[model samples]
Target: MPIEKFAPISRAACIGGGVIGGGWVARFLLAGIDVRLFDPHPDAERIVAEVLANAERAYGLLTSAPLPRRGRLSFCASVAEAVEGAQWVQESVPERLDLKRRVLAEIDAAAPAEALIGSSTSGLKPTDLQEGLTHPGRLFVAHPYNPVYLLPLVEIVGGAQTVPATVERAKAVLDAIGMKGVVIAREIEAFVGDRLLEALWREALWLIKDDICDVETLDDVIRYSFGLRWAQMGLFQTYRIAGGEAGMRHFLAQFGPCLQWPWTKLTDVVDLDDTLVEKIGAQSDAQAAGLSIRELERIRDENLVGIVQALKAGQSGEGWGAGKLLKEFEQRLWAQAGHTAPPVDMKAPLELVETRVSPAWIDYNGHMTEHRYLQVFGDATDALLRRIGVDLAYVEGGHSYYTVETHLRHLDEAKLGEGLVCTTQILATDEKRLHVFHRLHAGPERREIATGEHMLLHVDTSAGRATPAAAQVLSALDAIAAAHAGLERPAAAGRAIGHKARLATPA
Candidate 1:
């Protein structure tokens, strides 16, 4: 099926409200899909609210892309009410097969016939859950990792009666919302990820039970060692690299014989007797070192953000793995902004960029740093260029505008979380050059925070020298310059560095 044929989900229903369900709500709402949620727990609202807050904080640190406005959220009285008009329905009630089956049946009866249903069961087979459903074709397992808002992977599993089109549509929706969906070829008790995870978990339990290592030591082993490699490159690829230039075959040959050794007790099950349970619980408490669960979640989220950002900067900024998905998501967001942006008044400066001061942009003085000012101005310049038919495709074709000279005047402070907007005026333009001025304003009052005057040269990047821009770009630039010709020039336009300002006498 062609991916473009599937419309992005506009509304969704979540039929539970614990950790996993709340995470799903966060992901859907952040993607601009309105959500109707149902959960009978007395504190369901509070739980989801706390989770949403954490998700929001993490996303603030995630990317600079312009996210669509958050979708509205409403609590529903029951599963039937929640699924009334939802295009996508997610069931996260619990892991028990009977409970899931009952809920799935309820969702099937009330949800729109065309609505896609996803079960968040960690290990239950989709076949078992869809047994009595009226429309089994649209139901599938979409198991996700913990902290569903942050983790990108969703294991999409289909059952005997599942339709292939359903899987295709699910993948399309997942892509639109910035997620990776891997379709399982065959259903099993536990899907691929958990199967691998269960094996490791079994061994870890045995180790703890036998007193070979404490919980913290075991965690440190993974986080400090192969965990680093696993973040960017999964197990197989990491092993391929470890094969030392000869690749997977050589590595397999060297390590294949070790599989026969009795190094691991794979089949052994640790009895969760009272003594063992208490021992593990005590060690876990000590490992936490008095930090609350929410605190730990935030720390984990911050670390994940840093790692993902690093990977996004990998391969000379093209991105890798999940970072690659993020880069593509940001590109789509930029394209959406361009299309949905309101028509500007050609007679005034163009409001080219609207953004908030991110957490990372602050310095020790609790204001935007010196270099970040340049970055924001550069973004404004890019927005202007994009406005005039200069875009990624144009640059990829070997031409772009390069900033040659810039003069900046700092007027006031831009603190963290402040909403900022940048307006660009084309002071003058020709086939080979563009002279532009940008004013950055902060807060609802639109107080001017900074001014930047820049001189840009059109260039054929391949030739490494100045050149005249294409005809379309020139035409667009001409129109903007003509509109701004009657406006007064900014005072900072011709200022030189180190120009002294008059000081107030004995303030």
Candidate 2:
């Protein structure tokens, strides 16, 4: 369904407040849906609040586009109170079948009859979940991953009594909130994604049991190798690329027989005896030595943001999986806030990038470091490129503008937490080249902090040589250049790096 036609779900209820339940609450609230929550556990409020805090931090770093005003959160005392008047409901109760059955039945009875209910069960079959529900058609499995606000994938599985429209409606709602709904056609125990994850997890446990590798080593095997590839190309496509020019058939022919080998303990179960558990626990503790869980989580979130940004940087046209989702989210945010980029100022520099100094960008002197200045300027340049139609689609067609020269003059220090903006001025442009100037200002005072002069050469990447940019791109550049033609040129446009004053004559 198109995003514009998504059901107007203003209120949602979360039936449980464990990790997954809390994550759902975060996702809903961050997307501007008021949420009512119910959990009998005493610590439920604290737990969910922590999750929401983490979600807010991650979402803040994820996109700059404006989001809707935050939705109100209500903690309800009972399941009935939680679901009352709610347009949508989600059940994240314990995985025990009997417990879920009772909880889901309660929600079904109390929630509006037309409200769609989603189960956050990792392995349970939807058919079992809907067994005795009063409104079985509205119950389906809408499983989300950890840090739900950041990850986009959701598995939507429907049971026998579930109406097809239930799945579609659930998908549309999730899509509206920046999630990708992967529909599962048939009811099965441990649906696709989890099943694959379980296989690897089971094998890792077995490896630990056999003393072949420790927990840390197994993690390294993943994060240092296929894990990176999986972020962009999943298992099959990674192999296809590894197959050289011959592709999947050659890959299958070459390695298909290896599947029968006894290299992995995927089919076997390793007993999690006390000795093994203690050993793994010790190893994990060692791996995270000196770092509190929260600190580690912050580090993890920071790394995730950087990696996702990298993926977004190389995206092409329709873009890659996660990167595409990020862009869609930015677009949705803009649409929700009725935001449009301000028109370029012909007589003044066009503000390209505006961001804050993240704590990570600070150095020993309590200010943002030098290299970060260039990084921020690069991001500003990227913004300019996107605005002028030198985007992923244009680059994917084997054309791109490469920075051939850049000169940065650092004027003043930019301290951590200060907001910064980079403004671009067109210096010159031609069919194959672009010359531009950018000025960085520190805010709330808008004091000039730095300036960069850059020259970019249009390139035909496939030919590995300089080439004329497409007519459309050149036209956009020409228009901007013409608009700024009468403006005063920057005094530092052409500069040399040297001592201008008399060289220590008194000495």
Candidate 3:
């Protein structure tokens, strides 16, 4: 299962733009945000470009259809300009409390009051991170795992000062950026992901230090068993199924006997001896040997993508997934549209129009007004997007365009009932922008009536800014125009394409 540009993030700001920060920036950009980077460190541009390239590839693995083009990323001279009107500011400075405080202060000062400021602090609580902010209520801990572009979980926890509205808005932002965020009801140290992983880290060190097994062996033990299940469905949910209809109570009763046993012990901490540390670290390196970090990262991302898709498909251990819910959404829309099937020629192009006059077009003398000619050309532009792409399906993915500029020239006008026809021509296109020229003609007379020029920019709905069209779709548009070029342009009302992916899998 897959989702293509599930939601959109139009504009975002990333404060640190280092490895992790750069990853965060890439994730936002790929989801169609015009992200601003505010890092002062050197090599910032190099890191961001690298991360962006990797993110595009990772996003490709998640879906087969064309993904929206990577949004433009700019390196701002200061944090203030980078975050001034941003809807979301992701602060990823070094985890020192003092540094975090300074960054938060700057964001709170510069960002819009309605904007949400979140820190990517792994273990820092909201109070710790927002200690010096002007309005700490809008600040919260939004800890995302490493390699954020591929992994999708972000743990959100807030302090006493945090407002629930801000937290909910942050969650909506996360959804638009295609990430899962779990909001912790109460602020806690270490947050959820670290707390869950800490238990495993302690036990893994014990086996290596006690000479029971090597690091590779211990990792394999869990990866072969628990890792597979955890990927598709978490442990608690898995146990619910294990208990049958009796649920948690039955599972607890069955496992209660082992509570007193030493199988599980959280009170003990294993000290890492120097020799053992060297041995395991080198072995771990050996296990990961011969591959560059980039290569390893690609492999890891591919695996995660496959696992996540499986979970979404309900074919993995999780018996139910998002695909089922989405089918209902599709079915609901289909029902609303009625069972009556649209004509197969709904996408057919009319060769010509015999009549184009309307009551609104008539003046006192029943002659068509000059403005009506331009109106026909304007309608032609709408016909083009639906023909090329950006139909209902693309719009649902938050991929639509707005005309920023237009120029019209009217050559002739006819009587109220006179015939008029129109033709559209593709002017030019790039990753994020499109330009077109349209013509309206006096039908059968073979005389030009009106022509207009237009320039449009793709937009992301969530952040309310321009972004680029998806790659595969841009290519499809090119192919479509090439096919129709030099052929008589036809009327489009009877020829609109439906808003649905031809073959894209749904999640």
Model 2 regions lying over 4 Å from their true place: 1-5, 316-318, 339-354, 357-507
* Best model per lDDT: 1
Q: How well is each residue in 1-507 modelled by candidate 2, as lDDT tens digits? A: 343344657899999988788989998998889999999999999988888987877765565555666789999999999999987899999889999999998999889877889999998999998898778998999888876767788999999899988888888888778889999988789899999999988988888888899888899999999999998888999999989899999999999999989888777888889998999999999999789876786677766765666666565555567877777777666444323445667567788677767655677998888988898788777777777787766778899889999999999999855778889988899889889989999978999999999999999999999998888888878888998888789988887575455255665
2 versus 3: better TM-score goes to: 2
Off by over 4 Å in 3: 1-9, 315-507
Residue 341 in candidate 1, Cα distance off native in Å: 1.5
Residues 1-507, candidate 1: write the lDDT tens digits. Answer: 465655588999999989999999999999999999999999999999999999987886677666888999999998999999998898999889989998999999999988899999999999998899899999999999889998999999999899998999999999999999999999998999999999999999999999999999999999999999999999999999999999999999999999999999889888989999999999999999999999999888877886887788788899999888888898998777655655789899998777766656678998888787788889889878877888777888999999999999889999876778899998989889999999999988999999999999999999999999999999988988999998888877888776556544565
Each prediction's whole-model lDDT (CA): 0.90, 0.83, 0.70
* Pairs in clash, predicted candidate 3: 68-470, 393-499
Weakest 10 consecutive residues of candidate 1 by summed lDDT: 498-507
Which ten residues in a row are the worst by lDDT in model 2?
A: 333-342
Local error of candidate 1 at residue 189 (angstroms): 1.3
TM-scores, all models, native as reference: 0.86, 0.74, 0.63
TM-score of 3: 0.63
Per-residue error at 123 for model 1, in Å?
A: 0.4
Task: Tell me which of candidates 1 and 2 scores higher on TM-score.
Answer: 1
Residue pairs with backbone atoms closer than 3 Å in model 2 (clashes): none
